[model samples]
Target: MSVRLRTALLPLLFLAPTLSPAEAQSGTRPQDVIITYYNALGHKNYAAAYALWDRQGQNSGKSYAAFKNGFAQTYATYVAITGPVRIEGAAGSLYATVPVKVTAQLKNGQQQSFCGNYVVRKNNTGGSAASQVWRIDRATLR
Candidate 1:
């Protein structure tokens, strides 16, 4: 292969193992939703991350402006799925509890860590195509 072609393809090879945040949002698995959320946050795509919440951010318990401002001091974030996701079904909806450990680096050079579970839900009954995918219902982190 030509040097230019090989160089161009090198980056693609490195990215093959991970999907972009947009692509990840289409994933059917609960864990994928959580991963996509964090990925968006890490990329500073607050709108995409906020939309991952149930009811399109209404269930996030914060206004859109507040949600984005909340990360003003955040430089970057990393999340680790700490345990196996627990899934259950109730009233035609599927819920998944995902354990995670998150570390955030602030713009001031401070780091904050949190560990907890996030409840993700998917509607199995009638709804728009967007609603059928898993979404973050709530979170308990400390």
Candidate 2:
């Protein structure tokens, strides 16, 4: 999808602002975070995309430059969520694994599809109400 189209659709993707305390306490799903990540990627907003990664991804031997450069070879990329993302949670754990099917279009005019899982963890360190957020810790793409 084009950047403009993706930008236009972002509002539709995230219908609400911050998650209510009730929703957060019950373990909110990471659908919005995942979709927004894809939106950043679709727009080729490397900085925005990289910012979605949790602390785990940041310290995973790949620097911010590498993370951004990784997409340099791709063009007109589109990430589609094929179905409802299933998030598995454990009692008292702040992390969840979200499995999803994604279709991507590469710059080589090739399309790649994969069933992968994104590890998302919630953090509440920031001072604002919206600071409590779910972030992508790692991605197992195959």
Candidate 3:
């Protein structure tokens, strides 16, 4: 019985070393960053949502105050990842394009729809550890 138990546990030991605790905790995937951004917005956590943008929200093209105020008339928001996220590497960095559909429900019960791509990026070269994690670089919505 001990021999069989050891055999069963052996595979798990091999797999354990392949998984990194830091990677899991960092939410490095591009899709995860997109989801987290929208979820924060939906919950009205503007600061949390804005910080997901690159350059600490500078890449979002709006000041933190303006970004928060843009949603003043929005009662809630929803997002659907409409297609597969694609990641490409360039200049020692990874860029991911995530296609998404979003709906914003206004306080007056009006809904606005947006379809666009969010370009997320991660620095693969030299930077702080936090900079290595994915962040929204830019968004093109219509």
Considering every candidate listed, which one attains the maximal TM-score? 1
lDDT of 2 by residue, 45-89 (tens): 767667667663483348888887887766544444555565554
Q: What tens digits encode model 3's per-residue C-alpha lDDT throughout 1-142?
A: 2555445433422221222223322765677787777767766889988888989899999999999999999866777789999999999999999999887767776668999999999989987888788888999999
Residue 6 error for model 1, in Å?
A: 29
* Cα displacement (Å) at residue 127, model 3: 3.6
TM-score for each of the candidates: 0.83, 0.66, 0.80
Say which prediction, candidate 1 or candidate 3, comes out ahead on lDDT.
1
**C-alpha displacement of 63 in model 1, angstroms?**
0.5
Candidate-wise lDDT, in order: 0.80, 0.61, 0.77
lDDT, candidate 1, equals 0.80
Query: What TM-score does candidate 3 get on C-alpha atoms?
Result: 0.80
RMSD of 1: 7.3
Q: Say which candidate scores most in lDDT.
A: 1
